[model samples]
Target: MSKKILVWFRNDLRLHDNEMLVEAIAKSDEILPVYCFDPRQFELTNYHSIKTGAKRAQFLVESVAALRQSLQSYGGDILILNGKPEELLPALVSEHEIAEVYHHREVASEETAISTQIEDLLWKQKVNLKHFIGHTLYNKEDLPFPIKDIPDVFTQFKKKTERDAIVKPCFLTPDAISFVTVQDWGILPELSELVVNEDIEGLSQDSEFKGGEEEALNHLHDFLHTGEGMALANASLKKNEIVSKLSPWLALGCLSPREVYWKMKEAEANYGLKPYFNQIVLGLLWRDYYRFMFKKYRNTFFKPEGFKQELALVPLADSELLHSWKTGNTGHLLVDAMMQELNATGYINTAARQLVATYLVYELKVNWVMGAAYFEEKLIDYCPASNWGNWATVAGVGNDQRLTSSFDFQKQLKIVDPKGAYAQAARA
Candidate 1:
């Protein structure tokens, strides 16, 4: 009998630098790759937003299609399905006579719950489930301290980790994958099927951030080689032009953080690019910090009050205010423009994100979670930890809680949207 195993695809969607996929290929004679479009992701949240908005849904659809294409090129195919993984995998195992399951472990509670459910179900069949950590820039084992002892402050974490830790080299894409043939390979879900809003066609035209590893690698290469990558190191550039627009790919695991880190270092060494690339690395560090914080804090950031007790207060539930903020009708020119861009493009600049989050929490007095929830629905790059963790920080209740006064939005307005160009473009 052949050793058959199932490689479960979650957020880590790419063929290159994928540890779980490589491991599965090495361990089994025949392997099946599976992706589940969990219905829960598309359902309405308590905050009254679709769990997955149309723009994000469309991106995901394209990403999965790209993954399937990559797999086919490697003499394998991904088993795409649009249901819960726990319910789908057992049947797959039984039908395929699979021997084991492999997947990258996740930190968020809902994802953890689903993994736990699948593990228990697989165990009932006397099959083993293997978990790998592939998402963070620094692996958990390589961290200077255990997750529990990681500093609650961002600066401390950054200093200690950079000094003491190292990133593991990314795994190369496999030479060939021997696939176990299966009937009924599933179809990718339509954007309308995955989102609540009936009108999705009009917004599907923006090519600003198409999904896939190909786009990700291409963007990184061009950005690092072109004037945009060098100017920040050598000359001053406008804010919008400075952004690489790689977050959406990073969020969906189409681009590995490790790959980004290595490629940036290579670009610096070979081209003598200025230390400005370190700023990009710093952003990746913040992303890793948030994920590790999620493992340590364990659902505190998602609480109605937050991780701190004394900071507790009743959140404002004004529908009109929340709607105003969500729909870009808040009357603040810069913030309204930012929200409008996010709604249309599934993205906005980092500074704009911070400004809008602060506006939602301080000026509108709406619940911070509501704003985070909306981001979760809309951001093409919405990683659970990064989105929620940043919001909690702005709201004064994150792992790295700020001790300063609320942002002077009007002061920031001049700095982030200087001369109103970003605002004007957004409105146009």
Candidate 2:
């Protein structure tokens, strides 16, 4: 009997450095590529905001569309479906007589729960569910400490990991994937189909960023080596100019962290490890730190009071305040401008994110989870670990060692966006 495998595309969307896809191609005689648009993700959040807002939904659509085209070019086609994975996978397994299922392991609580459910369903059918770590820069096993032993503070984790850990080389992209026949290649849903309020004015479609493996690789090349490199190198010295806008592609898994790391190393070699270059590497380290922290603390990372923290009696989740912040009508110029940028483009620099989040949590006294959820909906670059963990920290509920923390909005504006270039552009 011929062996067949179902390669489930989750957050790890690209063909390059996709360990699970590479492994499946090696082990199976035929491959069934599948991507499911989970309805649950499109539903409204507790804060009365769509869990996946227009900007993100549109980006996801573009990403998946790009994935489908790439797969087609390789003699394989992705079965893009609009349904729950647990419901869809079993049917695909039985119909195709799939010997096994292969996918990247997700670390967040909800994602892990869904994976567990699918594993259980697949087990009853006697099909093996294989998982690989594809999201992080360093493999979990390569880390010096176990997940439980990952430090509470990022500095400690970064120091230890940077000193000892190794980032494994990325898996090679398969030259060709053996295609399996399927009658229905489900239609890829548009923003109108997935989101109810699709006609959101000012929610511009022509974002500076476009999603896909092609765009990602191109951006990586230009940012690291070309004229774009000179621009970034020049901008790195200034606080106002962002060094790279690679987070959206990173969040969608269109670009792997390892790929980015290796490219940065090459740039460092050519340009002699500038502080700005190191800063980019530090950002990637911070990403790894958050994922490891998420792995250790699990669902507690999302709670108002995070792990090892005392539960507070303070009422979090003030809906009215949250709405004001989300809509960019907070009456604070910088905060409102930042919020507007986020709402319109689904892209904001790290500094702007911190400013608005601090304003919402500290100044307005709104619930941090509300702010996080709003970002989850709005941010094109939203990763569960980075988004929630950062929110918890800012809310005085997560990994911060400080007793209290808040960003001064005026001070921040003066330092980062002085003369209001960013604010003015955002408002316009």
What lDDT score belongs to each candidate, Candidate 1 first? 0.86, 0.83
Model 2 regions lying over 4 Å from their true place = 198-203, 232-236, 308-318, 403-415, 418-428
lDDT of 1 by residue, 1-428 (tens): 99998999989889889999898889899999999999999898888687899889889988989999998888768898988899999999999999999999999999999999989999999999899999999999999999999999898999999999998899998998999998777888777778786378687565768888898889888888876886765667643447778889988899999999889898888766645567788889999999999999889989767777886575546489899999999998778888988988899878889899888888878888899999999998998999998888888787665533546667567768768887787666
Q: Number of the top candidate by lDDT?
A: 1
Write one digit per residue (lDDT tens) for candidate 2, span 1-428: 88999999988889999989888999989999999999999897766667898889888888999999999998768999989999999998999899999988888998999999999999999998998988888889999999988888777888999899988887888897898898888889867788855565556667778889998999988877776566555554442354589899999899999999888888888876466576777889889988888888789877776754556534655467778898899887778887887888998888888888888877887767778988999999989999998877767777755624446656656766778787687566
Using all chains and alpha carbons, the TM-scores for the candidates as numbered come to 0.96, 0.94
Cα lDDT of candidate 2 equals 0.83
Overall local distance difference test of candidate 1: 0.86
Residue range with the least summed lDDT across 10 consecutive positions in model 2 = 233-242
Q: How many times do residue backbones clash in model 2? A: 0
